[model samples]
Target: MSDKITSIVGARPRGHGEAVARILSLAAAPTFAIMALIAAAAPADMLCAAMQGPLSLQGMVPMYALMSAFHLAPWLRLVR
Candidate 1:
C-alpha cells in the first residue's frame, strides 16, 4: 500500500504530508465547534453592533452550527 491508506488492513505508514493533513483535519472540527460555542454565548447586540445592521442569535447560532457541521467530515474519516 502507498503511504496514504488509513484503513485497518493493508494500511501503510503516513508520509509527512499526510501527517500534516491528518493533524489539520483533526484540529479543524474542534476549532469550528469552539467558534460556534463562542457565537452562541455572545450577546446579540454586540454582534449586531460589530457587524452593523440587524443580527440576532437566532441567525448567528445556526450559521455557525452549520459551519461546524460542514467541517465534521474529517472526524468521520478518522472514525472509519
Candidate 2:
C-alpha cells in the first residue's frame, strides 16, 4: 500500500523507537500486577513501618492493581 493510504488507515510503519515503546507498553500490565501482588501478600507493617503519613501499602496496592487493570486493555485488544 502507498504511504498515503497506509497513513490514512492508521497503519504507518513503525520506527525502532516506536517498536521499543510498544514492547515496553506491553510489559506494563504484568509489571503493575506483580507489584500489586507483592504489596498485597507481603506484611504491610514490615513494609511500611518506616513510612509515615499516607505512605503505606494500603494506598500503593490499590493503585498498582488499578494500573494493572487499566493497562490490560492493550493485551485484551491483542487477544481479540
Candidate 3:
C-alpha cells in the first residue's frame, strides 16, 4: 500500500523508468485477505501518536480507511 503511493508520487510517466516503476509498485500490493484485516484494525490513533500530530486523527481515520480500500482494491484487480 505504502509502496504503491510512494512509487506513484516518485515516478515520472514521461521517463523511460515508467514501466519499471509501475511494475514494481503493482507487485507490492497486499493480498485481499490481508488488506481486509488491516482495514479492520484502523490504527489511526497509533499513527497520530507516532506523528505527534498537529492534525486531527478523527478527521484522518476516514481518509485512512479510504486509502486502505484504495490499496486493497488493486490486488483484487478491481481498481488501480
Best by TM-score: 2
**How well is each residue in 1-80 modelled by candidate 3, as lDDT tens digits?**
55665465454356446656555545554443355456446665675567654444445444555555666543555254
List the candidate 1 regions with Cα displacement exceeding 4 Å: 1-14, 46-58
lDDT of 2 at 14: 63
Model 2 residue 34 lDDT score: 99
Better of 1 and 3 by TM-score: 1
Q: Estimate each model's TM-score.
A: 0.59, 0.64, 0.28
Q: RMSD (Cα, Å) of candidate 1? A: 5.9
Model 2, 1-80: lDDT tens digits are 35554443343536655555555677899999999899777875754655635544356788998899999876776577
TM-score of 2: 0.64
Error of 3 at 38 (Å): 11
Instruction: State the local distance difference test value for candidate 3.
Output: 0.53
Question: Which residues of candidate 2, in runs, are more than 4 Å off?
Answer: 1-13, 46-58
For model 3, state the Cα shift of residue 70 in Å: 1.8
TM-score of the candidate numbered 3? 0.28
In candidate 3, where is summed lDDT lowest over 10 consecutive residues?
Answer: 27-36
